[model samples]
Target chain A: MTTLPPPSPRKLGLVIDLDTCVGCHACAVACKEWNDGGQFGPLPDRDAYGAEPDGVWFNRVHSYAVEPGSDHAEGASNRCAGPDPESPAPKPGLTVHFPRSCLHCEAPGCVTVCPTGASYKRAEDGIVLVDEDKCIGCQLCAWACPYGAREISVRKGTMQKCTLCVDRIYNETLDEEDRQPACVKACPTRARHFGDLGDAESAVSRLVAERDGYALMPEFGYRPVNRYLPPRPRRDAANAPPAPPREETLDREKLPGVLRWLDRVLSR
Target chain B: MRPTFSILCFTVLSGIGYGAWFLQGLAWAIGPICEAHSAASGVPWELCPVAFWTKAGSMLALLFVSTGLLCSLGHLGKPSRAWRALSQWRSSWLSREGVFALLTFVPFVLIAAQEVALWIAVVRAGPDGTVALSGWVSQGGLPRRLLGFCLAAGSLATVFCTANIYASLKPIRAWNDRHVVPAYLSIGLYGGCLLLAAMTVDRSMEFRDHRILLTGTIVLAVACAWLKHRYWRSIDAQSSTTTGHAIGLESLGTVRPLEAPHTEENYLTHEMGFVLARKHSTKLRRIALAAAFLIPALLAVLTFVLPRVYPLTVWLALASGIVGLFVERWLFFAEAKHAVMAFYGR
Candidate 1:
């Protein structure tokens, strides 16, 4: 069974909304808290009190500031800015907070590169996992991973990675509402959404369709089940008459043509 | 990219060991032509008896290979679980390598046993005035021929498997190339030839065809150096795949890393983000080239200048070759930039 399994029918995964994320790392903290006592618990730390402190965490948030007009060539500055080619205007840049974990890719390179039959991807749910007992901890799996998902725990002397909170998601003992991944449930901004992406009618799929969700490093061809919604372009809202006071707009629209029209627009 | 000591030792030492076994097999295939010119030249064996050399050479090869295998095991987190590595040879290059290296021991043992038997018979038979070339290397014998063939095939396959381990990694653009296997093969041959030359010349004796062996070593050493130079140049001129392209962020804008996920170093950064100073690397490369190839080649030429220099030159060649290979192997790992490092902005 070292060979890869056929594609799973139910690609259960998460979709993250970049526009709404505040980069508070609540999800990352929640993930550590739950998983520490879950399947792969006590995700150990070393030299905690020393100058160099290192530990393992399934979810890690990375912030990136996409500079304005950095991608544009010299003369094409205004030509390709503002997202759409027709806009012909530059847009202000915004920082994006990326919380990364195992993508549970359909073709997980980490799984295929294992010398021992330690790493595997589940055909039922597309969750990539490591068999701790079987792993020789050669760290080759980490090398094969393009997203830096695989981590070797020197303390445990085995490879570990995000299991997508499998222990909780399928646990029938827990209440139905609490069965979701720890990160998704604890996200304060409600930026994380989880559902079966393979289902056409799934809410996550609809969000993906609406928000133009994209795969990270698609060229690597991992075909990650997770998707990220890019930050929306800022609305300029530049052209407008000065608004009347709030109390004045609330008054009845009995006025001259311009005032009435402005009141109506403001009220609506 | 971290250039761990165990791995550098394993790759370089094991390569020479396999190369030696393969050449011995080739000599077996070619019959007594290899041994005829040696003992018959009335040359004196200044080291030990010729039988001792035959037995000792095979032992040295086994020692090299076993030490290398053991060194590699040290790098594994669970050395006790190393047996599981052989399970996935059908799909994994590393699995295939473990299988092939283990399989090579069969032929290696057989060849060594044959040499031991021959040596014992020679010792019991006493100093039979003329040490007939036909007495030792019975190339026409069916058992020896078959075993030699197996040894050659097995050794070559092991080398190929080792090379494939690096070449199969798609993320390492420098390793995944046509140049990798040939570089490994040629270098293995060169290192093996140096070992062979050193063994062929007995410090207590002189060999007539020692010139031929050392000459072959020179040729192989030069070939190894030339191929390595070409590989280095190719990698230097190569335009590596960018992080922007890796992340598919080129279409959006310059994909600069705003911050690392962790403040402290993780396994990925420690292993993949290994960086060596350019000036130090260049200095090391020079030392490796001089020791591994240049000095050996020059000493080999000096063997032609006078017969007295033959044994001394072979010893120097062997010494320099080992040092050179070690430095070269270190550079191989140190210079390699893993694709995963792109995320860390390495």
Candidate 2:
């Protein structure tokens, strides 16, 4: 009547600090690199070098300039400014970089809609997953998900999603410090953190309490496990002196060959 | 709620079939007790041939139901891989539907076999002779009664399965409600009553039994109409899940998207972006009323007023009612709003 070893408790989740993120897509690239090589390999890119470049990425950072309660002549108040070049209005106090991924919702509609039982949330850790062997490529689960988490793998004819770098994070051979998700590790500004929110003493738990983190589309009642800290107010840039004109800028022609090459690459 | 045409056809057709069976059963249960005059009055009770006709109706009903089931299987992306659907009976409603549908077949087959065997035995025994068989290995009375129970159980189970399929969808606000089950059952009853009216109405202009069926059909039809109207009104009053304040975009207050995700329609757009215009929906509702309720009601009233115009009116009303029900079922799926609409920024 005895059973084998019980499933491991690995509550993989993401903690995004909106204050530090600069809207750069480093975490997205890191996620693609790690996921493409590890368990859910090769997130197929359609027309990578073509005119319409589209592919699946586990993480996507959306940039928005939020103006907090602006008293403008046009009667625009609390409006997110359009990212247009022609706009001559004063800049917003805060620019937000929102990175979205699977929240790993406790009440996952994706799993329940799967006729073949391919999509399921792990009872052990609450990580939502799709069983490739059982999937029938119905795409019903994708339709069921409000977050747009599931992406169809055309080649495999099955749904794929963020696994939070499960294979790498759980690897015993890797060092404890190096076992975090690829996105969390690659966050240059240290905006992304990975930990179990279930544990009250966890880093993510502590941060959530301190920052008053919010979940995306809370009215949907998905009860997303991931937490997003709101962006802090911008510093007073009006008092600071403006930079020198472009014509009076320091000459780059006198720089070393290596330095010039580095400049060119960075500029590109 | 992705409206597979197969399922729509199945529900509509099976609704008629089950409705016909239910009406016929009701007639059978009540006809003997009440000395109600059948339209075919000249035809004797022994030679009335009601049993044979009822059996035929049952066969036709089961055929349509099975055809619907087959069509539904086609909606599955991998039909051969559908076996795995039965594995998650513990939590999944789809699994429950599959299991119940298969289980319903046992009784359906039993009813068919028993009825067919009884017919064959009757034919073999001749008019007057008592056909006798061995004690333990013989002609059974229990089989016929068991067949009745099976047909009743199967009919109910099939309807339950249909209701559960829609009711299980959590994202669709229209489907995930207490009203869905009752609405489905009512539609099924309406479809059955129309079928029964068509079958019982005398071809040579007989008035008996036509009024009762017509009245029953009208009541069901009107109830469906009322329910549908209420459902739509409720949905209209409901607010969007996403608000301007929630998205941090209060300047363009309560914004609806001018464009969709892609230039060319993707899977999500194709599946969920089906928008029936208000004018078209209004027109369809009128048509549904004419076919499902008005025609049947008029025919029922006409049967009492002009007894000579019985069969033609009843048959025409039934034919129109069925077509109307198909349209109604289509609207039921089309009108439903999924919670995912919030993500689309609708």
User: Which clashing pairs does model 2 show?
Assistant: B19-B192, B20-B192
Best by DockQ: 1
Q: Which stretches of candidate 1 lie over 4 Å from their true place?
A: A70-92, A236-268, B35-54, B123-140, B202-209, B240-243, B277-279
In the range A1-268, model 1's lDDT, one tens digit per residue, is: 4578998888878898988988888998998888778877768878877888777778778766665544445424544344455655443256667787788888887777788999988889888888888999888888777777887887888888888889989999999999899999999999999988888789999999998988877766778888888878755456456777776334554588888888789978
lDDT of 2 by residue, B283-330 (tens): 877777677777777776776678678667767877887788878788
lDDT by residue (B1-346, candidate 1, tens digit) is 7888889888988898888878777666654654564446544332134434444555677778888889999889899999999998877778888998888888767766666565565676678644343533443465776777777778888888888888877667677767899988888878877787777736433543455567788888888888888888877776666655545445566555777778898777788887873348778878889999999999888877765665788888889999999998888778877787776556
Which numbered prediction scores highest in lDDT against the true structure? 1
Instruction: Give the Cα error of residue B268 in candidate 1, in Å.
Output: 1.2
